[model samples]
Target: MNEIWIEKYRPRSLKDVVGQKDIVDRLQSYVTAKNLPHLMFAGPAGTGKTTSAIALARELYADSWKGNFNELNASDERGIDVVRGKIKEFARTAPIGGADFKIIFLDEADALTSDAQAALRRTMERYSRTCRFILSCNFSSRIIEPIQSRCAVFRFRPLRPEDIKKNLGQIAAAEMLSIEDDALDALVHVSQGDMRKAVNSLQVAASLGEKITVELVYHTTGMARPEEVKQLLEVALSGEFIAARNRLDDIMISYGLSGEDILKQIHRTVFELDIPDYEKVRLVDRTGEIEFRIVEGSNERIQLESLLAYLALVGENRADSAD
Candidate 1:
């Protein structure tokens, strides 16, 4: 099996992890002190939490870091039994290189049950001297209070477009691939501040050995290209509601696009449509509201259909008023 690009290209040191400068700076202080707290890295996926933790372990422990670091996924083994047993086994040993403590990196800690978390809390206290725990989760709220209280929490933000572009440009030069300017921008836009997604898309495009284009990024992300989305908008503007709705359904099913993904495409496509500036702004504002509602457990298909119908009405109104 081919190794996944995300893992293969994961940042090896703190300097290589992009974005989150404040968190990195604070972490550097901890490394300098040779005294680290239990850490809770709360952030969205693909934003370098795990990578930073591993990097820290490697930096602090040097050659024998592997034996001193234990990494586990809480979601994969969801019970306290495995966690308790592993911690018991790993924490029993002293640091191989005479460091103060070994490191245990627990990923997806939010997946643990409350009972499991309680058990984990006791484990943290019991092994406090021998092992430092770095817990990572998408949401900090799901972690139990006692567990949360023990750690220094760091919130990681999504990478900005500039950061993503800089990293992608570096990778492109190293991989010997040429990307069109617009295509690079499209990749950054589609990735939405996730560097891992940006790199993976770049790697896939590079494998094809062609100058990366906007259409390629869209296909790689399984979203309709901006041009196709604009085409659908034009059909809506012409008051061909049935045709436009049909096209939306076809695209969703063909590409497996989520409701949120469609909304993002619509938001971008609106600016490209030939419409009054005021109308474009108004439509996008309404689209944002509909997207929020869909995310909050509203029926996705119905919410999206409502958005399309509203766009069609606006388009028809503009046409009639113009006439």
Candidate 2:
């Protein structure tokens, strides 16, 4: 019933993590040896990097995990002073409760500035005996090479749909909510393999009603229904320019969707169309260009209408060739 289902249902131990089996098995090996090298976890957001770090610390130190583990977000204090002050003070200190070494988790380590990273490398070297570092980032290339060389890098991949569904299903049962099959599919579509986003979407949908339906999920998430989006494309492809543009206006206003959002949905729908492969390729290419224009501050309405006009033209051209 808690509002934040993601954290509420966060796995306490690494074994409970939904995906990343190989990473979990390797981390368990370190736990068995009661030793760990400096580790770098490179992955996209919401892929259990923080959970793994917390779970590792707990498994390693048991009751004293809190005392022996220190977690800091580098994005909040990404400067040389933070590296020298808080990081150094923690690294140089001895572990409490007779533990061999303390663990310092630096989340978003890629956000640290070059000067701060240079300072951190020396600190890491100086405190090797008393401290081990776990650096988490979205991109490993942003981290300096020296730091990369010092740690064993583990890359986390996006969760598969089945894994995300399994996790969400578990949450649904625990919360005593009923979810339709189509609704689950919608969650998967919107989340794009992000468990946190899926769970959060479910939580928001649940608050709106007792039964989670496909409509509820899309409404809560501010995304147009897949069927509606596909229909829009179908109408445009039929060369009904005025009708399709009217439908586009309704979809955008009703869903409160931005131009980019609609474009992304259209892009996905393009591949699903029964049209020829060549046509799909051309549509995707044009979609990318429109996306770029929108990003550069062009009027969303004008660009979207232009796309509809193009689709109508494509339809017209196809009719001519078939004659």
lDDT of 2 by residue, 189-235 (tens): 99987888899999999998779999999989999998899999999
What value does the lDDT take at residue 209 in candidate 1? 62
TM-scores of the models, in the given order? 0.83, 0.96
lDDT of 1 by residue, 61-141 (tens): 888889899999999977878667886688767888789999989999999888789888988899889989999999999
User: What pairs collide in candidate 2?
Assistant: none
Cα miss at 64, model 2 (Å)?
0.9
- Model 2 residue 101 CA deviation (Å) reads 1.2
Candidate 2 off by > 4 Å? none
